[model samples]
Target: MKKYLIPLLAISLIWGCKKEVKKADESKEIMTTEDEGWTYLFDGKSFDGWHTYLQDTISSQWQIEDGVMFYKPDPDKNQGMNNLITDKTYKNYELSLDWKISVDGNSGVFYGVLEDKKFVVPYMTAPEIQIRDYTNIPDFTDKQQMSGAIFGIVGIEKDVANKAGEWNHFLIRIDHDKNQGSVILNDQEVAKFPVNGEAWEALVENSKFKDWEGFGITQNGHIGLQDHAHGVWFRNIKIKEL
Candidate 1:
């Protein structure tokens, strides 16, 4: 009886160790393949590497609800500059996300954001991908001010933005090596412009951001979302450096 018990215990221990080893191996394999170069800015659960621009912590205007990055503003507490930004900056990368804006709302996805104390808003130092509800937002009347535009630098050639309140996709690519960048909305290529050189300089010179000192000057900076004091949801946020 003692011999049989010892054998069974040994078998159980060996089986347990084998299972643990298998799990570790599986985890390593998945990590290597699935998430090797892709960085999830929003991890679908928490705001791990995100914070308000120039601030150490996230503001009340931004919240992670369920698995989505939600913007729920307080009219009474609204300072109008509580934009959310990434902790780390990237030089050249592919950024993708899904966003839905409230009717008549306004927002933006900004990159190359220089969070300087001299600037009160991210747009002052960063180029923006305008996020607006085209259904009712009347303040911006230019095609360059609509969704997926290089916000004022160039207009979106294609009108691919979905109606407000419906989730829309955005894929923004920056390749400084080729001196080209693109904006794709709803899987359709809508805008392409020279990211550098004389063409880029001319566009900047004529746009609203022309007077801004640091706007589009740096190649690497944080990515951020404009808190336009309205309801907007952003999720499935991720980036892959190019």
Candidate 2:
């Protein structure tokens, strides 16, 4: 009876080990399925797929710490307005990211950014979605310039961003195939506009970009993070190409 008891215990232990392995494999399979068709723009370790606009290397101001891409402001650096941009160009995709800004700080996410020797900055050709400390900035009254607005081109329906220091999530979908562009802030639809065609032109024409040639013209371009000389952090940046 004792010998049989020992064998039964050993058999039970073997079954438990098998169950554990099965659970692990099932978790991995679920994770893989969830991640399918999505590409991470920032790997959370280093800036491998990004660089400074018009430059081959990223500036010292950009740092990867605590799994976040942080813009460490250094007033004495005198680096000018050098933005970080994706090395590859994307035409139609859904981009998701998280951002946080310091008090009274301002920055922007630019899409369809054309990088050229003639163009000094990305804003010359890209359409920006404003990222600012809206709740804290006393003078920021314009809805068109508020966080999640297509900066000056299109305004948000409502302010859905968290306060200055809190993390806000932005899910931007730019699909020229459907001729529609939209911004989802903090899981709410904040802004939507035409991606191209006459309506897009009219929006740009009424804005300050009216005189800026090639502004929002190209369908394929790079995504950019503006350097407004304020402390900003970005994380969980990923994209799904359509």
Candidate 3:
């Protein structure tokens, strides 16, 4: 009985040691470290890496105040509804941002924006994660048109958007290599879709973007923030390459 107990005790010890080591390794992997491949798109004080879509510079309407990136329409100098786009392009990445829209306001965060002026609008070349005031916007006729929708390709089931003037968190993970992506709004995972292949193409063909020039045609492009002629604030914008 003693000899049998010794062997069982030894096995238990070995198993316990292996589990402790694995937990430590996982802890290190998730620990936040400096230069963890995260790049700040909005560093609180400056819009250093961003510009107006199809333009070489940031517009005066876009401003930074209290560390928030905001858009206040010039009213007198409204440009043709172009989004604020990243000067640098990304291929596969995980993006996170926070936004608060004004009552009746509407905006969007788009990826895969092909920046040729010929397209005229960012939506013509990319997919948008809708930023909208869900309480006041009357245009949301379907789930696909609601906040956090993949902008027509698919509609999100969770309506977790906060009230206007309240902050809403968003995380968008895009992986071209895996041909998959997802959108999370206010900590609720709302949508997932194929980025490429027949599944992706079928959705495009059935949606409003079927004939739009360059829409979802590229795997890599600029990130975009739509003005939508509405007042909105964005901050804590960061991205990590996958």
* Better candidate number, 1 or 2, judged by lDDT: 2
For lDDT, candidate 1 versus 3, the one ahead is: 3
lDDT (CA) per prediction: 0.86, 0.90, 0.87
Give lDDT tens digits, candidate 2, residues 168-238.
Answer: 99999999888999999998998999989999999988989899888899899999999988889999999
For TM-score, the strongest prediction is 2
Could you list the CA RMSD of all candidates, in the order they appear? Answer: 4.6, 1.5, 8.9
**lDDT string, candidate 1, 1-242, tens digits:** 99899999999999999999999999999988976787889888888888888788777778787789889988788656789888898888999999999987889999888888988889788888988886654454688978899888899766777888899999999877788789899989888988777888999999877887878877778899988888999998989998
Runs of candidate 2 with Cα error greater than 4 angstroms are none
Q: What does candidate 1 score on TM?
A: 0.83
Estimate candidate 2's RMSD in Å. 1.5
Error of 1 at 81 (Å): 1.1
For residue 29, model 2's alpha carbon misses the true position, in angstroms, by 2.7
